[model samples]
Structures are given as structure tokens and as C-alpha cells.
Target chain A: MNLYDIATKLDASILTPKLDLSRQVHCAYGADLLSDVLAFTRPSTLLLTGLINIQVVRTAEMAELGGIVVVRGKPVHRSLQELACACKIPLLRTRMTMFESCGRLYQSGIKPCIKDPGCECNVCPSV
Target chain B: MSAPLCKKEFFVQEFDFEHAGKAASDMRKLLMDYGFDQQIVRRLAIAAYEAEMNMVIHGFGGTLIMEINFEYIELVAKDNGPGISDLKLAMQEGFSTASDEIREIGFGAGMGLPNIKRCVNFLGIETKPGQGTVVTMRVDLGPDAI
Candidate 1:
């Protein structure tokens, strides 16, 4: 689904609405550590995490992630927003904790990136 | 897909998480504009960003040098001091010695080297504690090139 749909489902606020919120996301990868995210994330997926730094945006850009969802009411830096704008990806914020947001997205048919869905990996919120 | 096209260098500073991925993003943008495949550019960017982070988090900051050719993309990162004591251990996933300050920013998971290795076809690292580290990563375009 698109960012607008995902944001509505998770009670998230879109930070970059002009970023073509119409981009579809097949799955979501939730991780605070970028290494795990890089290893496990699928292209065109969304990145869910509590980290709100420039590197996280960089990781999303590298992984070609569809967008970013910052959980737990974290404040996003201006540089981060600029990076997202330059990268042409949407960034969203939610008062929802990482686990809760992932659970919400997962229940909405947005499974993890594992090829065989439900393959038991911790990267995607299976809780 | 086999000719040297362009080169650029990005300077990174220790504890400078604010601008960690600038080089990678710029490089990826240039490659994408040059018509490289998304996958290739992404792979190159991942490795490049990881190496640059290592430089900032572990050493006295350094330069991320990117050399792009038709056949491959090469990333060379050279830092000035406080090199890794053991590369073998550093290469292991989840092995990290990042300070608490670095970890506070959510980056010290010890996956830097491993992640870099994962994205590149060839990886080389040389370092000595108290001196510095130099890393070289290469992603081959493979046998099929348009």
C-alpha cells in the first residue's frame, strides 16, 4: 500500500507528503541497527525504527527502501528531512512504539521481506 | 560498462553522524543519473556508507574515495588513527567496540565490516591500532553488462 494508507493504519503523520506518497510498499523491515536492516531488507520496502538520524536515511537510500517510519515520538532533525527530500522518499512519524507499529503493519497484510513469508526472522516485527 | 568514468572524495569526521552518508548518497545519485542499474548503485552505496561510518566512529575521520568505471565500482576509505586491533574479529557480525557515545546514535552494532563485505564482491582492510585503517571495497558488474 502507499504511505498514506500505511500512515492512516498506523496513526502516523506523514512528514513529506510531497514525496510521492503513492509509492507502494510490499513489506517492512524494522531495526535500530542499520547492518541488520541492510542484510535483510528488500528493495521497495519500508524501514521502521526508532532511530532518527541522517545515517538511517542514508541506509534507506542505499537499500532503496520505499520510505521510513520513525516510532515512539522521536524528533527528526532538519538534516534528516533534507536528506529524505533529496532522496525523494517519504518520512513518517508515529507516537506508536516500534513493536506496536510493526504489529499494526504486519496485521494489515504487510508481511516481512522473507521470500517465503513467515519464515521466522526477527528483522520484521512478528510480535 | 568497462571504462573509468568519474571519481569523488568525501571527508568524514569522528563523531560526525550528522553527515555520515553524504558521500554514499551523492555517489549513488551520480551513478543513477549515469544510468547504472538500481541494484548496482545500491550495492555500491551500502558498502560505501558502511566504510565511511567506520571511519567516523572508529578513527580520526577520513576520506571516502569512490571510483566508478563501466565494469566495477571501487570505494577506498582511509582513516588517520586508532585502527582496529583485530580485523578477523571485526569482520564477525555483531562484533563491535564502539564507544557508548557512538552507540547512542544507533550505529555501534558491530555490523559495519560484515555489512560492507555483504555488499561488495571484493573487500580488503589494513589497519594497526594507534595508526589507522584503510579499507577497499569493490563491486563487480558481473559477466552480464548491458
Candidate 2:
């Protein structure tokens, strides 16, 4: 799905500055731990988390994540938004909880970016 | 090792979660300025940030000393605090001693040591209870390693 579809589906606001909504989002990761996300996530995956801090932006930059979806209707700070703008990472706010957001994306054909071929997540069909 | 091409020292205040990743970010910039490869730079940045956050979350105020060479980069984090008793367990993926408050800030998922190990070519940890912990990590940029 594209950013526009996700925003429309979840009633999310495009918090990043001047993003192209047509960018395709292939997979999504739902986690609050930046370290875990950095360790496991692949590039261009949309990150869904409840953690509202500056490190979210930094983690997205380090992992080369496509965008950030803040769950639970939390308001992102201006500093984080500015950093997202500077990093060219699209940031969005969603009223849906993390589980709900993940479920919606999964039902919409988005999967997790699993690097390991032997992993057994249903969305990740054996790499 | 010889003298580093560039060496930077940072003092990380104890229990300061807000400014934990600054040193790592600075190191990333330095590596990029030195024309390091993007993969190497990313690995070093991730490893450095994990180590730096560990120091902040677990150790007391400490020093992050970075040495960048033409062929590789080395990050040495030394802190004086209550040290880890079980190095093996500490290296586990889901083992964390970070408090609830730290968890709320999007860390303490018990991936620090494992993530650092994953991102570096070589990682060494030395800790003695009540003394300190010294984590030395190196990422080589040679043709054979990459």
C-alpha cells in the first residue's frame, strides 16, 4: 500500500514534510524498542511504534526505514517532526493501536521484511 | 594500532536517556567525513549507538572514546558502575536489566549487546562487579572482511 492509502485507512496525519504519497510500502514492523527495530528491520519497511521520542527518527535513519507510523494517537513532538523532515522520512500519526494497525496492514497484503529465510512468520512466506 | 586518524572523546552523563545517541551520531558523521563505505559506517553507527546506550542505561557516567583509522574504526566505552555478573546471559536477546522507565522510552528490549555484536566485526566485553565494564568494538574496512 501507499502512504496515502495508509493515511486514509487509519485516519493518520502526514507528519513529515512534503512526502510523496505514492511511495509503496512493502512491509511493516510494530515495536517500541528502537534497538530491536534497528537490529531486525530491513530498509524501506514502515515502522509502527508507540514510542514518541527523537530516537525513533534516528533509528529510522540508521535502519533506512521508509516511514514511521506512531500508534495510539500520540502526538509527535516538533523536534521529531523536524528531524523526520530533515531525514526525508515520512512520519504519520494513527489512532489505531499497534496491533490494529499491524492487522490492517497485514490484511492489506503488506508483510514483514524478514531477512532470515528460515523464519516462520505467516506473512513472511519462508523468505 | 597506531595513533588514530581522528579521536574524539565524549562524557556521557549517568542515567541520561535523552542524550544517549549523540556520541554515536557524531561518530557516524566522522566516519562519513573520512570517506568510509556506507555499509561500514552503518555498522559502526549501530554498534556504537548500542554500546553508548548500554553505558547510559546500565553504567554510571562514563567516557566514550572513539578512534578512527584508515582501515577501520574502534569504539571503547568505559564506565565505573555496578558491573554485569553474567556476561553470557547479558548477551542474550531478551535479557535486560533496564527499568520500566527506560522501557517507556523505547529501549531495554534486551537487544543492546546482541545488536552490538551483530553490527561489529569484533566485539569484546570486560566487566567486574563493582568495578566497571569496558566494551571494545572494532569494524574493519578491508577487502577481505567486507
DockQ of each: 0.53, 0.41
lDDT of 2 by residue, B1-146 (tens): 57887789978778876676777777777777877776677787888778888888888868889987767788999987799999999999999989998888888989999888888878999999999999999887677433
Give fnat of each prediction, in order. Answer: 0.72, 0.50
The residue pairs in collision within model 1 are B1-B70, B2-B70
lDDT of 1: 0.82
Residue range B1-146, candidate 1, lDDT tens digits = 45567788888887677777777778878778877766777778778888878887777789888887767788899998688888899999888998877776778888888878877788998888888898999888755532
Q: Which number leads on DockQ?
A: 1
Q: Which ten residues in a row have the lowest lDDT in candidate 1 chain A?
A: A118-127
**Residues A16-42, candidate 1, lDDT per residue (tens digit)?**
867898889979988888877777786
Which stretches in model 1 have alpha-carbon errors above 4 Å? A116-127, B1-3, B143-146
Residues A1-127, candidate 2, lDDT per residue (tens digit)?
8888988878898887487768888988899888878877776789999988988888887767789999999978898898888767899999999989999889988888676666542212133
True contacts kept of 2: 0.50
